[model samples]
Target: MRAGGFLIPVLLVLAGCKPEPEAPALALHPVPVQQRLPAQVSAPALESGRVSIRGDDALADVLSWTLPEASIEQPARARAAARRALAKGDLFETAESAIPLLLALRKAQPDNAQDARLLEKARAALLAQAWIALDAGEDLASLRYAQRHGTVLRTLWPALPEAKTYLDAVDRAGQAFELCVGGERALHAGNLDTSGGALELFRRAQALWPLQTRAQRGIAAVQAALLAGAQAQAAEGDFEGAYAELSRAGRVRSDAEAIATARQRIEATRTDRIRRLGDEGLMALADPAGLQIARERLAEILRIALPGSGAGVALRQRIDLVGHYGLFRPGQVFTDEMADGGRGPALSVLPRGGFSMGAPEDEEGASPDEQPQHPVRFERGFAMTRHEITVGQFRRFVTATGATPRATQRGHSLAYDARSGNFLRGSGIDWQSGYDGRPAGEDMPVIHVTARDAEAYAAWLSEQTGVHYRLPSEAEFEYALRAGGQTLYPWGVGAPPAGAGNLAGGKDVSTRGRSWSNAFPGYGDGWWGPAPVGRFAANAYGLYDMVGNVSEWVADCWHRGYRRAPSNGQAWVNPGCRTRMYRGSSWASAPAQARSAWRASGGVDATNARVGFRLVRQL
Candidate 1:
């Protein structure tokens, strides 16, 4: 307990609660005692002494207890009687006890070694008892017992050296206990750093008693408090306050391992939180209506993220692109609703990155036009139709706008002929016709459309959806076809994997029971003609049929090689060029034509059953 812990109510006794009406107003203590003034701060006492109500009653209590005097008695009788009392365990606090009786006998026979031995033995017993009481605990009763008896021993046995040494040891233990008590109170009140405050008191106690458990635990508690405060501040978005608390904790520990562990824990916790928020925001971009939530998540990231946080940067970019086409993540599939309740083709958001635009020169099955492999990168991401445009989707464009498709105007389009085992021009074949020039199913990919017819369809759909829609650039087409890989085929090297797409296969038996002479040895996709769009497994970017089914037209004009190709992945157009480039393998394409880098071109007005097109929306 510190000094002045309790206030002894005094002064203005007449104002006190009624005790006696006629008698003079009385004090609570019945006499004067030193008291602190109102509102005064209590000073921490190193050792708070026992308080007394300085009055006649207190004085009389102390005055009443007197020290026993050694009585004179015959030496022989005293020795016999003292021995009997010692054997009965009666040592002190009575005249009949052993110590006073020995003292009486020692005065009479100072030269007697037997009497001297008895006196010394009684003193040692008292000292040992005192040590047992003190060792029990630092509670008030134990402490008071130790201190009160120490004073008695030194006063009564003034000539004994051991008494003084034992007393000194007891005093040091008492001091250490008192210091920690004061420190604990100060810690609870948050007075940790003030002069003579908790930290100082704890250190002082440790110095006094090197192995004191109280002091050791107190220091650890202080450090824990500091670290907890730092975490709370960071949670509240107060980085300055959080760092300040961490710095304070560092001072308390200051060891390299401790500091590094503390910092790593804080950063790991924060990084995990930032990463979760970034992932949630990125997911929100997969839904166009979730753009608002994505923006909100990004705002939170900016507020709490550390400088140069990668999660924060990623979230910000995703938020920026969310408003474009209702925000889809890379490889995420989505679609837009047109004005007349018709939805555009399902599209997959393409990842923005660099890739080798054409096949490497030394690759197997490499073509002369695919030589000089060059780099191409898209600065901004774009969304590509997840599958080729289906016949049902194109029919909507034709039904809405009264436009004559090129194949319909020419009255002929090239189509597969089972008897000839080749594509041959036939009348009555148009965008509505199947590979065999029969009426195509709605789900089958639209074929036999010229490049201009495909472009016109994209333009009509753009007006319907209020967004930019066009054919993908040749570089974009190749990069997306590879889909984050550099491989000989879209699905990787060697023979095509099973069900890779509707590609030419050695096992395939056509309607005329004929298979290609040169085809993938063991691959079969279970299809003889163009299957429904997205019938096969999607590529890495969630796009389907980029290497098979039917080859598709791109925005780039025909080029001999990539020597003069655009590096930014934009369509390289030569004005008024009639020849246009188309890419990917057809269902009847040979193994060499199935290469990932394969390219071919035809007159813009040309139409064929083996060719189709898909569109991309600029983001």
Candidate 2:
């Protein structure tokens, strides 16, 4: 007994020192395997749907110490997580999280009828949220949710037939939205096939939902855009543009208003094509000779049909003005009237003859070609303008012959100053101002005539006077100035003597006068503008202003070189009259231009304030 007592004490001490069996680890790192009710009625489905959680246990077990009512807070935490996913457009995550809480609710209260209804509502809400995600351009999230939840819903749908119908409708709406979204994406990427396919599906959805306002508008807008594109292609000459347009038009609903509008638009397009064809036909036949006729016809058509179309109207007017007045034609001419009506005893025999033409090589104003002097012989004679016809003379011609002046005359004329190249509205001279810059007189030369107008006046004179009145051939003009002599000028082989002619007032200054004294050069008078045509000594032929005053018109087409020029005194009429020749010089021009051999050409239709003319005829 004494030994047993000792052993018992030693055993007790040994047991106490043997780490106390670790006291079950003092429950410090203890984990209780307490039964965990599901977090909600649908926790199992949520877990199956792959919703990852921290631990595979009741949520209450993990957080029971933190909350007095851990079971109640469990549903709230699950809902919060689901809400977070939904807000991020994560449809799959939202549905997965929500399902667990639903399962937990069902598990914790299987006998409650309301639990089943709650689960159904939760499932429906998840589906609707998935549709929302699809609408938000989240295609991957939408597909994930639809694949997982759709199977469940479809299976659950049969039991709740009404819910099945709702889910089906939601699915259809989502599909329509997806097709439209896909079409826009493809269009952005320039993939025609994908975009067209999606657009067609979008149209089908519109048909399926006949009462949906947004769907109808969407379909209408696409149809209109498609038609516009096809029309643009048609304008670019694509024949298939018509078929594309028709296809787009066919997509419109068969309502009377829409059908009628489409038909009207189609008819309008055909009309535009007809008009364009006519214009192209005209342009195809465009040429210089027939330009006038073509322009008149086009103007008449537009005036009668397209009066309000701005471009068409402008083109129509432009064609008429440019073509009719811009070119010359055969049998056109001009003439002078005072010579026929007044003092020289009606010397209507306007003789034309060629002479040794060109200025002398030693002359101050001579050009090189004017040096290799040549002779030109006129086989015929033309009647010429007697004393340069005055402005009053032309007014009388206009009144007696009922001829229309080429340019419109008005009381208010354009006031132009070449010094500044500026214009303003001022009325210093009347339209009838004579070439001499004096008031209207019977003997002064006419002024303010375009070359075309002068030609027309000459033609009118020819008809009225019963003689062929026209401009002198260039050879005849120079011959008359020299009077059959090849001298430097009509007077002698030197510059003009004082009082011999009107020119710049100094020897060096050939364009303007410098001092107030009249002893500058030829004219000796400080006349800044034209004097009367007879104010200076006449040439050997008794013609006036061969070198100054106003230049004369000659009947040769302007050409740059005489390489292939005709040797006879006749007009050059080839190439359809691109330019008209002007001989002699104007008051505003330098004396160099006044040289007998100097020749220049200008547009036949252009008129200048400084330009005027004398006419000639065949005798």
Candidate 3:
């Protein structure tokens, strides 16, 4: 009993741990046996007059049972039935089976004139059917019928006038049918032009047979093709072309749903195009050149009227604002002769803004003095001369002020010697004489003038014109030189582009006696000494000779580096400041020295052939 008790406890534990047994699998029932019945054969006879044409067996039975008896005994009655069938346009029965029966009648009754007349009627009926088929554009079927009719008519009556005339008509109709077929093919091929294309061919077909269905179908196909083409053009952003195509399609099928949908799509595309143009115009407001392009784009949009169009009004307001703010207008200039009866320098209005004062650190060959690039802002706009002060302009100043320039008082000036290939102080050379010791041209930039002399000229100009004329500050000089760019040079990061400005290009080597050894490599500007003012292309601000030809005097005192430069673009002047600052490289300077950020310090009284200046009038 104790052993049994232990076994029971172990069985209980095992039962708890084990999984339950799966349910019994489904059982399949046995298939029932089918019994076969004895076969029985019974044939049903076809009706006496009815026949089945469903298969060869049925057709053969009918032909054997019915054709022979009727064809032999009642040949005349067979001919009459075939004639009646032909008259009813039942050509399949009349031509395929009845024709043979009618031939048998003619042979059996060789002297019967009715048999010949019935054969002629059959041929005439076929000719009529051929004409009908030609009108329907069934060229293959029509041609087959025409040839069969011709063969039968020729065999029976070799010179039948009616047959010949019918055949001639069939030939003419065949031509028209072929043209209609070609029109349909061209329409399927997507040639839907109104003139000299598929549509014209369709119209010609209609003109030949006014009630032809093939021509009508060809016209409908062309209309559908035009609508489809319009939809494709609209998808490709050609709204005007799409609209024109849709209008043509409307003329063809005014009630077509696709035509209406295509017109709606064209309208939507045009509206979207106008909106895009307006957005582009608004985006261009920040740049002068882009703004002009924007104006053109917006004008185009206005040319095509849109519902609720505000693009033109908005663009006009933006343009007006730009004009009111005295923004730089390309090619706009102000010119007036000075009091001394000499033509004054042309001046271009400059916009007031902030710009970086020096070159960036990564710029190639950048100097340390141009470090700490900082922003300098101008509070008001100004107008600066488009070209440097010319010799004639300085002469007028001298004639009015009765002033003696430093170079003139010195009795000699530094001049380039072409024969010796070197620069030397030449006797009897002064401001009136050029850098080559020749009489200066009236249009050439005046040279060998001290900063004080330039200041005196500005003072005389301000007094004569009753305007605030002065030398541009160092910040203003660099700002105007840069124009609107941040490159190492005014143009861009590469070596100065050809004809940008007159630097120490090799153009002077043969004419001026000497060429800069470290000049911009491989550059030749075509001028040795300073070129006539405005010879080179102007900068973005419409100022010429800002970087080369001559270093220009500014109103700043020399402070080495821009350690604490003025942020407001004012001149950094101090009391008794002996050393004044000049910006830009001279004709004798290397390419790197001609950069917009390059700075040179000279005594206020210093004069040389490489130094000159331009003036500005505050507005």
Error of 2 at 215 (Å): 33
Error of 3 at 123 (Å): 99
16-87 per-residue lDDT for model 2 (tens digits):
122100001001011112111224421111101111112233322222221011133465555565445444
Ranking by lDDT: 1, 3, 2
Q: Alpha-carbon error at 612 in model 2, in Å?
A: 1.7
Report lDDT (CA) for all predictions.
0.72, 0.47, 0.66
- TM-score of candidate 3 on Cα atoms, chains taken together: 0.46
Where does model 3 exceed 4 Å of error?
1-331, 336-343, 506-508, 512-514
| CA lDDT for candidate 1 | 0.72
Comparing 1 and 3 by TM-score, which wins? 1
Ranking according to TM-score, highest score first = 1, 3, 2
**All-Cα superposition RMSD per candidate:** 26.1, 26.3, 33.4
**TM-score for predicted model 2 compared with the true structure:** 0.41
Q: Please identify which of the two predictions, 1 or 2, would achieve the higher TM-score against the true structure.
A: 1
Q: Candidate 1: minimum summed lDDT over ten consecutive residues — where?
A: 20-29
